[model samples]
Target: MQQNNEIPQFDLAEQIMAEQRKNASVRRKGPAKRVGAPNQKRKVEPLGHTIKPQPALPEQEQIIAEIVARDIKKLCKGNARSPRTSGF
Candidate 1:
């Protein structure tokens, strides 16, 4: 029995894939650029005249407002129970 010392040869498909990988690595060394459409600077236009924002309400007033809103919501709800009219 005789053993060969030569390196094993890759098949045609394996050779193509190896070549592709080698080419890909070579390409990765350089900075990549976009394929199409040159970048344009967009002009930002102001939408109408900006109105001055009103000052925020005081903390105490905000709390009172929230309470009033909640009570109003409860009264507006269709499922809210009405006071019993029958005398017990």
Candidate 2:
């Protein structure tokens, strides 16, 4: 006896898919709807006019010490020294 390798279900599926592709090609699609205002231009503000003036930063050493002290305090939890005495 010889075994048949052909699949009948796969052949049917292929035929159905071909028909769907033909139908889709014949269908008409409308133009896409506009999302936002296309004609309006964005208002530009002068540089630094909208931003509030920031205070001058402390020395680099002071900044580094403050960050280190904060991290140490976090790690030590309740054992860390008070902020006033720590001089952070």
Candidate 3:
């Protein structure tokens, strides 16, 4: 345990997540970087509605959403650009 200064059974990637491990100090990821055409507008998806294309929740956005939601009440207040209520 870190209480003993043990190298945690998990590491930087293994702690946050092996799946989330990054090679660079900054990481750029997700569908926009993978599929979407740069500078294009974000496509819309309706609940239970699937368009002819697209994967569910790009990994990067999902991570970013989680980070934003952690302090959502603080980060999103008065930011009308967001589509959903912060805790909605």
Candidate 4:
């Protein structure tokens, strides 16, 4: 029986992996810890005065009507016929 001079492939690979793992753990050690403020829930305070709702503008209705019209036009363009002119 003769002793082989070279290490087996799996053995060589395992040695490399062990070295890598040791280096990784050494690098993972971080700086020393320091004391900080204790974590506490924030305290929320109510507003000193109540907020009143603003009155609606007279043009708001017209602006909303224009938006609906534009959306309808877009929907109609995607389809074969407009619902307003379509016959059921």
Q: Could you say which candidate leads in lDDT?
A: 4
- Model 3, position 26, has a per-residue lDDT of 44
Clashes of each: 0, 0, 0, 0
Best candidate, TM-score-wise? 4
TM-score winner between 2 and 4, please give it: 4
lDDT of each: 0.77, 0.73, 0.65, 0.80
Model 2, global lDDT: 0.73
Model with the higher TM-score, candidate 3 or 4: 4
Candidate 3 per-residue lDDT, tens place, 1-88, comes to: 3467566463665556645555442476765666655797788866896568565678978998887887776566555667565545
- Model 3, poorest ten-residue lDDT window? 17-26
Model 2 clashing residue pairs (backbone): none
| Sort order, TM-score high to low | 4, 1, 2, 3
* TM-scores of all candidate predictions against the true structure: 0.29, 0.27, 0.19, 0.34
Model 4 worst lDDT window (10 residues):
79-88
lDDT per residue as tens, model 1, 1-31: 8999999886999889999999998776544
Which residue pairs in candidate 4 have backbone atoms (N, alpha carbon, C) closer than 3 angstroms, thus clashing?
A: none
Superpose all Cα atoms of candidate 1 onto the true structure and report the RMSD in Å to 1 decimal: 12.3
